[model samples]
Target: MESSSNFTPFLLFLSATLTVLSSVSANSEGDALYALKRSFSDPDNVLQSWDPTLVSPCTWFHVTCNQNNRVTRLDLGNSNLSGHLVPELEKLEHLQYLELYKNNIQGVIPPELGNLKNLVSLDLYNNNISGIIPPSLGNLKNLVFLRLNDNRLTGPIPKELVGPPNLKVVDVSNNDLCGTIPTTGPFEHIPLNNFENNPRLEGPELLGLVPYATNCS
Candidate 1:
């Protein structure tokens, strides 16, 4: 009779331990999402709808989650969010879609964004962001869509950006960027509009045909 009583207590203890471990794992994932949420400055309260107090980010509007309940998509396009791209966003390791197009965000693209290895689509077009495109973005091997058009960015387009094998759409028009456009990968098939409005840019065809003081060859 005494052995049965001891066995019952042991089973109860094991069950409690398993429950606590599951809760901790869920809390850890939630904390990671909360940290990224705190990075952005939502002036117009577009992201005000994102409440971390909720059980999971999956329940938040505009945020999509996977079967594991991890944040996978953040579509905030045309929401009028005005702020700098925060490096802390790298915390969302499972993020696949990050759409922030047609906003008023300013400042340089954060290099830390390269940490998102699973990212597939990153659209940040029609913003007022400036500065050079970070070469570190080449780390996203699964990226298919990347749009950075209609911004005030300057400097050379990183040749490293052409390394993504799955890259399909890349629009970087209407920027202040200068220098030669990459002649490899998806760049070779890109339309002329992709390189338009950048006064100092020299396309592949004009690289050797044009005669100028800059020596584009």
Candidate 2:
């Protein structure tokens, strides 16, 4: 058998290869974040630390990462940010908390957000976001807190939202939403006040009495 010393060169090469791969993964995540930074109008420079030159976005403020340097939480709430969210946000495969509440963020919520299977809390309240709530959000089975209240959103709440078994709190009040409020599954425990202020929203969905989609248009 060959001496152990013969493996030294092979081991060194393997180590270098791994280092390069780790750098590449970090850069990919950094790129996705930079895309978000570019899309926002940060007058307060809250995203100044989100430099693409860095090896990883973990160094950026408002971003939290795991032991493996994968992004998990983004706390940019109340940062005085405007502009819409980017679809590239779906690239954060390990992301859990996405807090962008109390901002001036406009435009529709990206449907790509539904791809974050590990997500738990998604707070986008008090923004100017409009458009129908994406049905794709039902894909997040791990979700718990979902607050989209105080926006300009229209259309019925997607029925697929009931799929998340861990969902505890959901607020969609103060919006332009129509359709009967869902009463099954996770929506059973939701407070009536949470569903208040929606002038067009019909009361709880009565089973077998009328279609839930009635006059929802």
Candidate 3:
């Protein structure tokens, strides 16, 4: 009987430990997002609700959480936000959709974003963002929609971006990108016009065909 009573205490201790760990994870996500908030110039106070002291970032506006209280979506599209993105965003392990389109954000896409394995959609279209498309983005196996149009981005579209299994929509048009468009994996189905408007971009690569100016200057 005494052994069984001791097992009860152990169960209670384990439960408390788990609760503490859960709180830590939640706080970490909040801290990462707050860091980004400090970096941006929000003209409309869209991020006013992002108070870190709350129980979890799940309560913050423009943020969405899963049933497990982990951040999964960050929808801040068209809020007129300007400022460079922060690599701290990579800490949102459960993040899926990161939408910040139609803003004036300027900077290179963070290579650290490649660590977001659960990412689904990465939309940054109609912005002034510039810099090479990070090859690290290819690591997001679940990525689907990739919109980076109307930006000043330069360099070859990373061949890695074409390999994500779930990629269905790719819009890098109207950018300064060069090099041959990929023609394999999910790339085979992406429309040709999506590659248009960029004067330096070369021919749409077919299977085994050489890419247009693979090495962009």
Candidate 4:
């Protein structure tokens, strides 16, 4: 009888521990996003609703959450937001879509974005963003659509972003990207026109030839 009572206390403690851990995990993501909100210059007051004191970021504008209240999407496209992206965004572990297209947001792609293993679509096209595509983005095995077109980005396309298992669409066109195009994995199926307008970018690299390291810098 005493052992049974002890077991009940243990069970309660374990449950409480799990609950606290889950809450902390969810809050961590919220904190990361709030950091992003603080980094931007929101000309449209689009991010004014992002109050950190909220129980969760699910209540914020341009943010979406899963059934578990974990952040899953951020739809801030065309919001006229400027300023650089924060590396703190890497904390959004469950993020699937990051849509910041058509904004004036400028700066380099955060290599920490590779930490978002659950990402599906990444659309930052039509912005003034510059800097080389991070090789770390290759870690997003779940990535499907990657559109960074019409930017001021320079340097060779990182070969790391070529072979995501679910990739379907990639449009880096109209950028200042250099080096030979990757012709492996998902790259083999992307249409040539999608890569058009990059003056220095070369071939869907040939069969046996050693592809450019794309690290010309």
Candidate that would win on TM-score: 3
The lDDT values for all models are 0.80, 0.93, 0.91, 0.89
Query: How do all the candidates rank in terms of lDDT, highest first?
Result: 2, 3, 4, 1
Q: What is the lDDT of residue 51 in candidate 4?
A: 89
**Candidate 4 C-alpha lDDT tens digits along 59-109:** 998899998788899999999899889899999999999999999888899
Question: lDDT tens string, model 2, 131-166?
Answer: 989999999999999999999999998999989999
Expressed as tens digits, the lDDT of each residue in 40-93 for candidate 3 is: 999899999999888689999999999889999999999999998999999999
Superposed model 3: Cα runs more than 4 Å off: none
Worst 10 residues of 2 by lDDT: 207-216
TM-scores for the candidates: 0.80, 0.93, 0.95, 0.94
Clashes of each: 0, 0, 0, 0
**Which pairs clash in model 4?**
none
Candidate 3, pairs of clashing residues: none
Task: Give the per-residue lDDT digits (tens) of candidate 1, residues 86-108.
Answer: 77678678899999999888999
Off by over 4 Å in 1: 1-44, 205-217
Error of 2 at 193 (Å): 1.2
